[model samples]
Target: MKKLYSLFIALAGILCFTSCGDDYAYTAPEALDVTKADLYFKAPGGTGSIEVKTDRELQATSSVDWCSVSVSGGVVTAKVVKNESIESRAGTITLNDGVLTSLVAVYQEGFAFGIDASNLKTLNANAADSTSVIVTSSSPYIVNIPSYAASWLSYTADEDGKVTFHFTKNESGAPRGANVTISCDDREKSFTIRQYDINSFVGAWKVSYADGEDLYEEDITITSPSTGALYLNFAPLTPTVTPIFHCTYVNGGLKMANGNAQGRYSSYYLFTLFSSTDGYISWAATYTYSASPYIAEDGTFYMVFANDGSWPNKETNGVALGAFTSATATNAGFVGTLATYTDLVLYK
Candidate 1:
């Protein structure tokens, strides 16, 4: 009878345990949690992971095509693609478990493609004429000047940050240009070097004038010479030592007045005219050079002078006008052929 009573008690305990199933409860894992402290990626690109704890089923995605994302075994995985361009890029990685969400920034470095400025200068030929272009990256860089521009353009850098570029004056007739490049660090920058044309007629020369066989050979210093006009100073000083040649471009013709360039003094010659009946007469005469210094296409030059004013206009004063040229023509003598014996040539 006592054993039967014990069996009954054990059956009662089993029944109570079975009846408690209707009041049972369940618990979830946890809210979203991330293990990574940084969100950036490298250029070569690779797969990275984020340890996450969530209460419900979760999914992961990327805002940019450069980044891809997925989730497996309670962990969010992100894959960053390689950045092959010359520019840096950025994007975002997103995580959500239906309601709660999280975002992380993704970044990758590109090439070193920038400088402080886009334009480069020339006639930078001077120490005072240097251009400091700041480098935009930490990688090593190099400067390149074209072969044709080797004589003028160049580059110099003490270390990196700011580099100095130099250039020389252009001496060509037409405008000139070249390409200047900064290369290295997987990138480059291009700059154009443009320069103006050089002026002609800018030096000294010896000049020769003649009345007979071997006449006057003098050094004539030309100053401020240009296609427009020039100032001429004679070595063998004349009463009016300085003359101005007002030039015309069409045919390279020149004109000058009786006075000097500043018109301060007149170019006058004092002489005596011998007349058979009237005896000898003294006079001061002035001549104006017009269409004078005509430079021919073949490089030959010519000049002629006419009387501007005279004290006595007599037949003996026929030496008023004179003409000269660089041709092989012989001098016509001071008293023959209205054209006096004259020659003008470059002395040197």
Candidate 2:
């Protein structure tokens, strides 16, 4: 027992001496080490912290007002601000622990207006009703479309908060395409649009031709609607008739089957030259097929409505004509047609 007691006493003394070997306070570390890949800030900015390892108190600060940093204990906290400008920005945060210093990169993404105008797709020439497209944007935006496209495209407003795409009929014989771009917060988004040919009957033309030994000149105009309704107009007609004439365009061609007749065309009053003495028969609705609309690479529209049949008065024939620039279409020179006349030719 005495030997055991002596051994215990010796062990206790040794343990006490080892426990009291050193009495030192916490000391500052030699380096500051941060462990984080990167910091991402949302719009305006946010607050976040990262894990750091160091024994001494640290100090932190930002290079720009967009970001700010502070240190508490072993961690570094940052306060990020959202970018109000359209452009994205970047900055840096520096941390120092007495003996060591470190750099951290802080990035902020650009502001988003959330503007989208990708709904519109295609257009038609003789459509009666206008087309529509919805626009979504939280911030202000600018619209950019080609001049030619803008001439026929617009915004259709029915009620508040009801956004629509409004447009006119494409009277050009050729098809065209355009791109609409929206600019927001210095960002850009583009959408594509297309227009189908509404044929050469979409413009005004000065009609000049020789009837027998006498020559007569007439003015004619054509219009296209958003509801696909195509019509033509003349100065004055006999029998007190309306100046507007309803017409049809189909499959890249024109059809005037009984244009001034009854039933389907009853709502409109046609027949521009209805005087039997005038000897210039108005366009008929029968067998007036084989007509097509075409456009040259120079943006000129032309039409071909020729038939190998004779009319009642047979005065002005060969309905082939080109789009009018100023007053007349000089491109159509000598169609060499006399469908309603004995010998007639169309010259520019």
Query: Which model scores highest in TM-score?
Result: 2
TM-score of each: 0.31, 0.32
Q: Can you write out model 1's per-residue Cα lDDT over 1-348, one digit (the tens) per residue?
A: 111100001112222223545743344433346555244554556776766677777787888998888888667777877667767787776777887666656666664446877444532322224455777653457787777667766777875567776665555433344566787645788765444322222345566555334566666654545555644454523454333333222222233322122222233221211121122222122432333333233223233322223334532211212212311122331121211112334321
- Model 1 spans > 4 angstroms off: 1-33, 41-59, 70-102, 107-120, 126-129, 134-144, 147-161, 166-178, 182-189, 194-348
Residue pairs in collision within model 1: 125-167
Provide the lDDT at 194 for model 2.
Answer: 49
lDDT computed for candidate 1: 0.47
Name the weakest run of 10 consecutive residues (lDDT summed) in model 2: 1-10
How far is 278's C-alpha from truth in model 2 (Å)?
Answer: 35
Give residue 241's error in model 1 in angstroms: 30
Best by lDDT: 2
For model 1, state the Cα shift of residue 307 in Å.
42
* TM-score of decoy 1: 0.31
